[model samples]
Target: MRGRHCRSGRTGRKRRQKQQSHVDSVSLCHQPQYVRLMRFLHKQGFVSTLLQPALFSDTGRGLQTLKTIKPGQLLISLPESCLLTTATVLSSNLGHYIKSWRPRLSPLLALCVFLVCERHRGEASDWFPYISVLPTSYTCPAYFTDDVMAVLPASVRRRALDQREAVQEIHSSNLDFFRSLQLILSLPVEDVLTYEALRWAWCSVNTRSVFMSHPSNDFLSGQDVYALAPFLDLLNHRPDVQKSFCLQVKASFNNTTRCYDIRSVSGTPHFQQAFINYGSHDNQRLMLEYGFVAQGNPHSVVYVDTDLLCDALKRDRSLDQKIKFLRENDFLNNLTVSSEGPSWRLMTALRLLSLPQTLYHQWKAVLLGQAVSEEREEWSLQTARTLCQCLLQDTCKALDKIFFLLQHCDQLTREQLEVVQALRQEEKCILGSCLEALDGMWGQRDGLLSCQPDVGSVS
Candidate 1:
């Protein structure tokens, strides 16, 4: 009797779990825009019936397979007709005005204009299904408010500000061109193409567009290599998805079918979310560009700038010469600390800086990885320790400020707060790991130094 009761309890739990799963899948798939998108894709002959939109607890909205997918299977094959590219814009109703404009528009700006115009058109637009499903607003740094920006790391904050300025410049420079559209748009061109609207459109293109090579055209000013793949863009990035399943999904233009296709390199279990690699980007790049950060990202790094290095090592008369050498050799930039402690470029720069003015002739040898002396090596290690300790302190303070902001800053949305918090935590983790590695190295060196006799004192 006892055994039978336990069996029934287990069966009841399984049934409830299945019911919850069904609810999660149906919630987003049944949305009006998603329903319309599916219908439109089918009408255009998109034939990946195995994949369907499903919501996951961790990843939010992503595509999932209804059944187990086999290796080398075609996951998605979207017709060229369905893609939104600069070519699509050239052939659009606005194409006539675009072609006649005095200066040609870059492929990117052209896409931004098209997205904004079509979004204004509502259901009247031909690509309404695809446009309707795109995120109405993006969380990219360009959209961050001043208060939110204040919480970002110093390096990331600078880039974030630059991104915002670049978008603003694009809008300011093209205002007259946008005004010219009054001839075609029923609404006031300025009203529809406001800075906010243009920002939204820019973010959409920047974050969601896939790279699809197109032929050079006199009509476009810059690189013609972006395509907006609608349903396929729904796939999110997962860093370890490749390692776990060997799922090498490659997206390419299928010239034979005149469509864009994605195929899996290995089998994926049924009901699992399908992910695509967006290159091996660090959390900083991911957050700055895509408005999200990946936890446990193996590629995550903590950047160390020249100013910070100078501060840690104590500025000396030879600092300018050292800086010049680094710049000339292309080692001044990209100095960073990772899980393995300071990068080689960082250590090399430190070794050169640690040398006395008397031993300056050995600078080239240091760059060549030739060991100069134990004293110089010890100096470089000490300098590295100081820099990492400073970084750890700064990271802790940033985390504290973020926590305070999360509690007090009502101007930021819940999502914005979460992004800021996650970024700071990731930095802290990297710094902590780096400090641990540095400590181990420092301890080993201390023991070795104690065992060796001083060269100056030796008989």
Candidate 2:
């Protein structure tokens, strides 16, 4: 859904550019398209290259600015004692630690510093300039020590230095290195380029939603986030919010339709289906456009515990870093677990598997309260069934909540609304199959009999 529609606009513009360049490469100031061209150049930091008129009249206008949030003026104060303590445990000589890092000053390290700074300041704007200028590839440690770091922006270097020093080091001996680190760390990186100019990643003021990290980079389907960016994660979860608004679905089973609601869960849903079409819910639209909608699905309170995923993640080097970071920083901690509610129990049970709701309902209904039935040897099947019902009910509520959020979504485009409609159809389809499967079971004399419900089309 977010594919062709999102790319067409860019493709069309590129085609139009060929014609525009042939017309008046000069007098760019006078061209209406010049403003947009200038904006693009500014956003990508290509103003100087494209602004040279005599050399090339193709793309002009240099003193352009993007819609990016401005760089933040940061001030993070820690207890002097804590700073002193950190200075001691993290490094013996701030100079040495900075020196140690000298062997490993990768771009990832630099971004980490900038991110920490932004988080400390509590502003997306704080990272705007850094994001625009950050390097994707890093040179060797030797270059970082002699050439790269030395030439970096003074501000960036200063911030980097401060972050290092905060970890604990012999402050007096490493003062000079710390200061140098700060200055060098801030310089605008060289030869940096990106296919997609992240022009800016600002917090959505109107939508009041934000995300921690973009999913397209090096991380897996759901990695790349730092705990400091919790606000960003909530914002990126627009899919979950959108799903809450769905009235029904085209269930995979039996192609049946049934009504669903989103209000079962009490949390405030930020938008509704109608808002997807108004072009106003930019945060939500961003997710849809990026094909990150699946990432934001309304997971009924059911899911696995951190320990399980962590153990699994440890064996894979690719997932290890993200898993460790999330654990160490407690990113998953922000995801609330409702201990005192039915929704919590239901979600917990359902998250265990990726099966349908009707089966879940029947299973949970049988095993939720009763003692282990002695008739059959193993209770695994019964236990599994009970959990399924809990999941089903919770899923229904999750969908209802999404719809509730959608009702308030007054700013999305018409096409986005169509996305919501598609999802609703899917929900109905699922529910219908569940009903059909349950009809035969309802007639069974013994509710807990082994005559399981027939399989449905939905998997």
> Each model's TM-score, in the order given?
0.90, 0.24
Top candidate by lDDT: 1
Candidate 2 Cα deviation (angstroms), residue 33: 12
Model 2 stretches astray by more than 4 angstroms? 1-107, 111-291, 294-374, 377-383, 407-459
Whole-model alpha-carbon lDDT for candidate 2:
0.29
Residues 256-369 of candidate 1 have per-residue lDDT tens digits of 999999888778767767788888898889988888888678888888887786665444656777678778988878888887898888889877777677887887899888
Question: For model 2, how does the per-residue alpha-carbon lDDT over 88-193 read when each residue is reduced to its tens digit?
Answer: 2123222244335533332222233333323233323323332332222222111122222232222223433443343223223323423444433333222111
Q: Spell out the clash pairs found in candidate 1.
A: none
**Which ten contiguous residues of candidate 1 have the minimum total lDDT?**
450-459
